[model samples]
Each structure stands twice: as C-alpha cells, then as structure tokens.
Target chain A: MTADRGRNRRTAALLISGGVLLALFLVSLTLGRYPVPLWDVVRILWHRFWALFGLSTPVVWTDAMEIAVISVRLPRVVMACLVGCSLSAAGATFQGVFRNPMASPDILGASSGAAFGAALAILLGCSARFVTIFAFLGAILTVALVFLISARAPGLRVVNLILAGIMVGSLFSAGTSYLKLVADPANQLPAITYWLLGSLSGTRLASILPAAIPMALGLVPLLLLRWRLNLLSLGDSEARALGVNTDLLRAVLILCATLVTAASISVSGVIGWVGLVIPHLSRKLVGSDNRALLPCSMLTGAAFLLLVDDVSRNLLATEIPIGILTAVIGAPFFIYLLLRKEKTL
Target chain B: MKKTIALLLAAMMLIALVGCTKTPNAPDAAGTRSFTDSVGRTVEVPNEITKVAISGPLAQIVVFALCPDRLVGIAQKWDKTAERFLATEYYQLPELGQLYGGKGEMNLETLLSSGAQVVIDVGEPKGSIREDLDALSEQTGIPFVHITATIGTMGEAYQKLGELLNMPEEAEALATYCDAQYARITEIAERVDKANLLYITGDKGLNVIARDSYHAEIIDLLGNNLAVVDSPSSKGTGNEVDMESLLLWDPDVILFAPDSVYASVGSDPLWSELKAIRNGTYYEVPMGPYNWMGFPPSVQRILGMLWMAKLLYPDAADYDLYAEAAAYFRLFYHCELSEADYDALVRNSVGKQ
Candidate 1:
C-alpha cells in the first residue's frame, strides 16, 4: 500500500515539474534585452507556428520582434533544455550502471575528448560547423578507445572501464592544453578558452537542429530499458543470475549514454554539474527506481538549466558562461541537499 | 633483437643532438655587449645584431615598425589582410609563434634556424617573469631582453629599443610621433567634455571593458568609461555585462571590437535600444594590419586616441582624420593609404551625421 502511495507521489511530482518547465520556457521567450509585450510574444509565436504549415496569419508585430523571439532566443532556450536533459539522463544512467553515486556523463572521457576536438578546430581556423562535428567525433572516439583498451587488457569489470576512461580523459585534456598553447592569443586562444567555459550566446537553429537527432536517438533507448537498468545496477553476477544479459545490457547503456553525452557537449561545450547534481536532486524527491528516476531527472534538469541560463544571459551586461554559473549554483544547492538528508545509494 | 633496437635508438638520438648543435653560419658575434633592460636585468647581447626574433605580437609590432629588415622570424603568420599593408618581403618571414597570452608554442628549432641573434619581448612583466625569461634564454642560448611598454611609457620604450637596435633615426621619428600624439590628446582632453562611453566586444555584445582595465587605458584617457564594477578582471576577454546593466549605464557612445557583434548588433532589437545604437554613435574599431584600438594595448593606441577624439567631439578636436591616418600608416605600418583605402576603412564607421 505504501509502495503504491510512493509511486502515485512520484507521478504527481513529475507532472508538476513538467508543467513548471513549460511555463519557464514560455516566460523566457517574453524576457530579453528587447521587451516584447506578453501578448505580442504569444501572437508572434502563434503566427510563426501556423505559418510553418503553409498558412498565413495577420502580421501584427514587427520583423525585429519576430526575429528576436524566433531566431535569437528560441534556439538558445531549446539548446539549454536539450543539453540539460541529456546530461542529467546520462548522469543518472552512468551512476546506476556503475553503482557509484559520483559517476557523471564524462566518466568515459567524452567531455575532455570533445573539448580537445573543438579547441583544435578553432586553432586551425575552422568554422562553427566543423568545431561541432570535431567535438562529436572526439567524444565518440575517446569512449571507443577506452572500451577497446579495457576489453584488450583483462576482465571487463566496471572498475577497469572507469580506469581506462580516466586515462583517456587525461590524454585528451592534455591535447586540449597543447592546442590552447599554440593558438593565436589575440583571437584563437580566447575563442578556445571561452568555448571550453561553455555558452549558448552564438546558438542558432541550424546548429541546434542537427545535434537534437543524436540526443533523441540516444535518449529513446535509455527510456525504453530504464526498467532493466534497475537489474543492471545489481552486481554483475547477481544480475546474470536474475536472467539479465549483463554484458549486452551494459554495452547498450554505455553506447546510448556516450552518444547523448557527446552530442550534448558538442553543442553546449563543457557544462559540468547538471549531469552530476540533477540525478541526486531527482533521487532525493523520488526513490531510485530507474523507471521513475530517469524521467524525473530529465524534467528537473531541463527546468534547472533553463532558469540558470536565463539568469546567466540576463543578470549582467555580459553573458556569463553557462558552465561557470551551473557549478556556482549547483555546487551550493547540492551541499544543502546533502546536509538536509543523508541517503546512501 | 632488443639490443639491436636499443642500438638504433642510440644512433638516432646522437644524430638528433648533432643536428640541433650545428648552429647556422652567420657573421661571428661581435664581442658581447651588456645593457640594462626595462625590467632592471643586465643581459649580454651580440654587439652587432643583424637579425632578431620577437617573443610575441607586441614585440613583433614594435620591432617591425623600427626595423622590418632585421626581423628574422615573426611571432605570428601574416594573413592576407595583414599582408596587404606589409611589404612583400615581410610576408614570407618564418613564423616562430609566441610564448605569452596563452599562445606558448615558441618553435625553438625554427627560432634557432632563423639565425636570430636575440629575442626581444615588449610588455608588462608579471610573476617572476624575469626568472622565466632568463631560464628560456639559458635553454635556447639566445639572450632574451624584456622591455616595458604601457600606453604612457611607449615613447620611452621606442627610444630604448632604437638605441638597442642602432636605428636612432627611425626610432626617434616614431618616438617623436608617439609623444606628439600623446601630448595632443592630453591637451585636447582638458578642453573637451568627455563623452560617457562603453567599449564592448564578443559576438553577443556582453563583454565590456571595465573602468581601469589595461585594455581600457585609451577609453579612460579619452572618455568616461561607464562599465564600472567593484573589482575588474583581466582575463582572456574583457569583463561581461548584461543588457540590464547596459541599459542602466546608457553610454553616450559605444565602441565595438573588430571581431565582435559589430556586424549584427545594428539588427539586434535589444542592442538597438541602446542610446549609442539609436543615435548611431556606435562604431566598429578599424583593423588593417592590426587593431587601431589597442587590443594588445601597444603603441598602435596613439592612432586610436586621435580617432576616438575626433569621433567623440568633432568640433573641438578639429584635425583632418584622413591626413593623420595616412601619416600614421606611412610611419608605423610603412604603407601609404590611398583615398580609396581610407574611405573603405572608415566606411560605416563614422557616427551618423
């Protein structure tokens, strides 16, 4: 009876958070340096939405308002949500699979590898498209290299994979440092450093749309197998005894997790704490049944990051890097959560 | 098999050592001459320096202005835009990279092969810089000289560099020009009411040159920099501000960096709300060979001063901007700016009449 009550409460919490996220997204569209009235913002969005399907509505607002709402702000808000959702989801999965509370999406060296690729591309004077492509490739390749090394050396223990990931992550981080060292200090070095810090300032619909495909492809499989993730969280021998093909399940999870992580970092640069903190925050609200935890973390992360990004761009005359604000806000909130209640996974 | 492999490696190591030690054949260094550098370090340089390498871009600009012929290796590769202003001979100089501003892949082998007698660095020194430079000098067997050059002290720095390079006539002329420009600006600064200005950079128009930053020296001297924060940061980019703060500040004029939001800012609805933008007092800083505004905060800022003075108060500081720009280009860049070139450079840059 109590278990039923808990499930009911979790469902309620999810619905509330989801509603909050949607409300925040709508509010964000109205807020910017250019003040578009609430009604005007709604009208502009409604007109654009209908216009997409070969329909025309009366154009009430100016082209500038339409551009600001549709072009400038929409992509940034969407990218923030997608990145937040992917990072949090990946973080939860990695922690569940590894049976370690501390594992983030970048446990497999994805963030570091992506950073190296982006830095190298910038150093070579490549365009933004090439930088994103290189970042994605760097992340996927680093994880692949990690899996290859761990498989070759010895038993496929989770610890072995984690250790290999650390080694590979360090190597790519060093490569990024070298690129920063060689870049033109006036233009390229600052570009690389700012990129590493992560901002959504230059986001466009063109960049956001391409990255969404990979994120969805990675996310769907995880959502489907979320129930089975509970079984995998058990020790390997125990999971196998319980009729779970631990090896196959682990491989699939790692692949999906890596894809989402690489794609997220590729678009947003290295936004750190959402993946690490959001899962913990979700777990505190809803107990760790991968079924409930995964979706809850996703919604929470999306809202959390959207709010942080809004503050980051709006709080000052200069847009603070989203990564810096995430750590600053997340780290303190995480500590408060820790002090409020001590729970072991 | 292992023994054979070890032997091969040893032989390769020996060859590499020999290759590195074979110094380029140049006129034998005249008996060493000792001179005190700006940082109070007395270092022995070759008495007759026929060739030289710069440690970074700041040094490259200063050295290039005085003696382009003597520069054996450039700190950076010249792009096509830079090449347009520079002489054809300077276009092909070997790129040795740099050791400062986080761009630290100074190719020692290339510097050595270029046959440069000494490496010259011109900038503010920081955090055991003397020791660091000394160590680098010892490692490369090339004497490194550090010369301090702030906006205020650039004239003196030029004079000192001239004495070191034995190009008193060229250095004196450049130094005199710098001093005269500085004096001219300071004189006019006293007479005119300073305009409230904010210098912004970055693609999103968030980065601000805060009051009293090293990069804001010219802005401070010429105008009232309104982006005042309690503690200013000197990182890769300038300090960041939000639209709310910018709206509150409402600067009378806004100067955009060359690679910043200057292109798209006019179309930006929020940016267009700014008094500077609405009044069309916003201007993109000009760049040909280098940014006229001191991005690196070098001697090039003298031109920025003249340009800003005219841009701010056209009536009070009445000088033929084109004539001054042409003279500056000829003197510092060693390129003649034709009327067409000047028009192209200043196109869409002047405030809307």
Candidate 2:
C-alpha cells in the first residue's frame, strides 16, 4: 500500500514539473526585447501553426515583429529547451551507470573535445556549419579514444574510464590553448574566446535542425531503458544475479548519453552546471527511481535553463553568456541543497 | 682527478667571461633628459630619440604617425595588403609582438637586438600598470614611457611626443589637424540631433558596443549610442546581444566593424528587418593601412571623424572626403592615396546610400 502511495506521489510530481516547463516555455516566447503583447504573441503563434498545416490567415503584425518572434526568438528558446533536456538526461544516466554522485555529462571528455574542435574550425576560418560538424566529430572521437584506452586496462573499469577521460580531456584542452595562442589577436582570438564562453545569440532554425535529429534519436532510447537503468545502478554482482546484462546495458547507455551530449554541445557550446546540477535537484524531489527521476530531471532542466536564458538575454541590453549565469545560480543552489541535506540528517 | 677539476673550473670561468661580454650594446645614455610623461612618471629618455620600440599596437600606431623611420620593431607585422599603403622601410622590420591584451609574447631578444633605445606605451593605464611597466623597464634596461591619449586629448599627446622626438613642427601639424577636427565635430554634435547609432562587431555581429564604452568613444561623440546597458563592459569585443534586442533598439544608423558581418548583413533576412538596414543608413567602416574608426583609437580616428561627419550630415560638413582622406594618408602613413586607391578604400563603405 505504501509503495502504491509512493508511486502516486512520484507521478504527481512529474506532472507538476512538466506543467511548469510548459508554462516557462510559453512565458519565454512572450518575453523579449521586442515587446510583443501576449495576445499578439498568441495570435502570431496561432497563425504560424495553421500555416504549417497549409492553411492561410491574415497577418496582423509587421514583418519585423513576426520575424522577431518566429525566426529570432523561437529557435533560440527551442535550442535551449532541447539542450537542457539532453544534458539533464545524460547527466542522470552517467551518474547512475558510474554509481557516483559526482559524475557529469562530460565525464568522458565530450565537452572539452567539442570545444577544441570548434576553436580549431574558427582558427581555420571555417563557416558556421563546418564548425558545428567539426565539434560533433571531435566529441565522438574523444569518447571513442577514452573507451579504447580504458578497455585495454585490466582492473576497475569505471575508474579506468574516468582516468582516461581526464587524460584525453587535458590533451584537447592543451590543443585549444595552442590554437588560441596562434590565432590572430585582432579578430580570430576574440571570436574563439566568445564561442568558448557559450551563447545562443546567433542561433537560427537551420542551425538547430541538424542537431535535433541526433538528440531525438539519443533521447528515445534513454527514455525506453530508464527502468532497466534503475537495476543497473545496483552493484554489478547483484544486477548480474538478477539476470540483467549489465555490460551491454552500460554500453548502450554510454553511447546514447554521448550522442546527446555531443549533439547538444555542437549546437550550443559548453554550458556547464545544467548537466551536473539539474539531475541532483530532480533526484531530491522525485527520489532516485530512474523511471521517475529521469523524466523529472528533463522537465526541471528545461524549465531551469529557459528561466536562466530569459535572464541572460533580457537582464540588460547586453547578453550574458548562459554558462556564467548557470554557474552563478547553480553553485549557490548546490550549496543550499547540501546544507538542507545535512539539516535533515 | 685534480687536473680534471682544475680544467673544468677554467672552462666554466671562460664561459662566464664570454657570456658577460656578449650583452647587446645599449645606446649611450650620456645626454639623457628627464621628462614627465602623460602618466606623470619622470622617465629619462634619450635627448635625440632615434630608434623606438612599441609596447603594443596603440603605441605602434602613434609612433608610426610621428616617426615611422625611427620604429625599430612593430608590435605585429602589417598585412600584405597594407604594405602598399606603408613605407617600404617598415616592411622588413621584425614583429616584436606585444605586452598587453593577453597576447603577450613580446620578443625581448629581438627587441634588444633591434637597437631600440626605449619602449613607448600609449593609452590609459590600468591597475598597478606603472609598477608593471617600471619592472619591465628595469629588467630590460629600456626606459619605458606611457602617454595617455583619448579622442579628446590627441593634440596634447602629440605635442608631448613631438617634444620628446625633437620634431615639434611635424607634431604641431598633426596636433593642429586633430584639435580642429575634434572641435568641429563637437560643435556640430551639439547643434544636430544625434542619430541613434549602433556599432555591431564580432564574427556574427551580435556583439554590441554599449554606451559609454571606451571602444565606442568615437560613436558616442558622433551619435546617440543605442546600446545603453546598465554596466558597460570594457572588453574589446564589447557585450553580446540578440536580434530581439537589436530590433527593439531600432537604431537610425548602424556601423559594422571591419571584421564583423559587414559583407553578409545586407542580405541576412533577420538583419534586413532592422530599420537602419531598411532605410540604407548602415555602412561598413572603411579599412586600409589601419581601420579609420576605433581599432586602437589612435590619431587615425581624425580621419574617422572627418569621414563620419561627412557621412552623417553631407550638407553640414562640406569638406570633400576624398581630399581629406588623401591628406591624412600622406601626413600620417606617409603614402599618397591615388584616385584608384582612394576609390577602392571607401568603395561601398562610406556615404554609399
């Protein structure tokens, strides 16, 4: 009876979080430098939705207003939501698979590798598309290299993988530093520095579309296997005794997590703390059942990043890098969580 | 064993003697004159200042204007395209890199070897900057002098530099030109309604020069800077902004930095929605030997002032931009702009609409 009550409460929490995410998304669409009245925003969105289904409607607002809402603001908000969802899900998976509370989405050097690739592309004067492609390739290659190295090592698979990630991450970071050193100080160096700090300032529908496919492909599998993930989080010996193929499941989870992380980083540079902090915050509310925890993390992360992005883009005329804002907000919240847990103990 | 130890000691002594005697020859300091520089440091500079090394790009530009011949080394090598606009003597000079802006790979060995008597830094000083420069001066034994110059104070800076270089006549000519141009702009600025202007920079042109930023001093004087953030960022790249904010500001005129999206912004659908672009008041800042606008914000900005004045109010500021540009190139860069060169530099850039 108590188990039934617990499940009911978890379901209620998940529904509530999802509702909050939807509300934030709608609020984000309405809020921007361009002051579109809420009614106008709703009308514009309603007209566009009908147009997508081959229906015609009279346009009431100016073309600039339409473009500002549909083209400029919509894509960035969507990208934020997508990135937030992917990072949070990946972070939860990594923490569960590793049986470590501290593991983030970049546990296997994906963020550093993606950063190096983007910097290199900018240094070479590649176009925006090539930069994203190179970043994606760099991430996958680094993860593959880490896996290969760790597989060769004999003992303590999880620890070996983490150590390998550190080695590979450091090497790529050093490479990025070298590129920054040689980049032209006037133009190229500033470009590289700003890109590294991470912003969604220049995102377009075209840029966001390419990353969306991979992210969706990665997310579906994660959602389907979430129940199995809970069992895998148990000790390997116990999970093996329970007839769970821990090795195969772990491999699949890692691959899905990498795909999501790399694709997200390619579109939105390395936004830290979301992937690391959001999952813990979700676990606090939903308890550690992966079925409940994973979905809750995804919703909470989307809402958190959306709110932060609104602040980043609208706090002043100048946009603050979203990574800096997340760290500023996340670090303090994390400390608060720790203090609260100690009080409970 | 005793013989080997004695031989080793003799070799070490010989090596030490050779090292001690191989120090690069310093210019004789017998006729040094102590002068209070812009930063109020009493630096003992050479009485007949000949060879000089720049501490960074700003210093390089200022020194280049006054005495291009005396520059022992440049902070960075000029672009090949800029070679035609510069003197041939400066083409072969070593690139000594720089000391500031986080690009610090200053080649001390090359600086010393090039026979530079002193290092000159131009611009406002930051925290503990005096101590830092003093330490560098003491370590390298090359007297360092700092001269602070803004858009308003170029004339005084030139006079000080002229006195130091013993070329008061040349300095007076440049200084007079700068003061007159600045005064004219200030007067015109007060009379006219300042055009709401936005300066966009960076690869994507999303970065904005917020109001009251050091980089946008020229913009501030000429127009009403539209990017009015609460706390203005001091970074060279300025602050980043989104398209929504840009649409909200809806500036009257937009100036694109040389390295920004000047080439593609005209056709960009979202950018075309801007009122400035729609009205054709947007322009790409002219670039040649150096950017005429605010890169380094040196004496070159005199030309920027003249160009902007003409571009903004064609009837009010009646001076021919071509003639002014030709004169600036000849005086500052020591290269005459031919009819073709002048056309190419300002082509589709200034007053195009």
Ten contiguous residues minimizing lDDT sum, candidate 1 chain B: B100-109
Query: Model 1 in CAPRI terms: which quality?
Result: incorrect
Per-prediction DockQ: 0.02, 0.01
Stretches of candidate 2 off by over 4 Å are A342-345, B1-353
Q: Model 1, range A77-184, lDDT digits (tens) per residue?
A: 898899999999999999999999999999999999999998987766666667789999999999999988888887657989999999999999999997875564
Question: Which residue pairs show backbone clashes in model 2?
Answer: none
Candidate 1 chain A least-lDDT 10 residues: A55-64
Residue B314 in candidate 2, Cα distance off native in Å: 36
The CA-based lDDT of model 1 is what?
Answer: 0.81
**Consecutive 10-residue window with the lowest summed lDDT within model 2 chain B:** B100-109
lDDT of each: 0.81, 0.81
Using DockQ as the measure, which candidate wins? Answer: 1
Could you give the C-alpha RMSD of every candidate to the true structure, in order shown?
Answer: 22.7, 25.0
RMSD of 1: 22.7
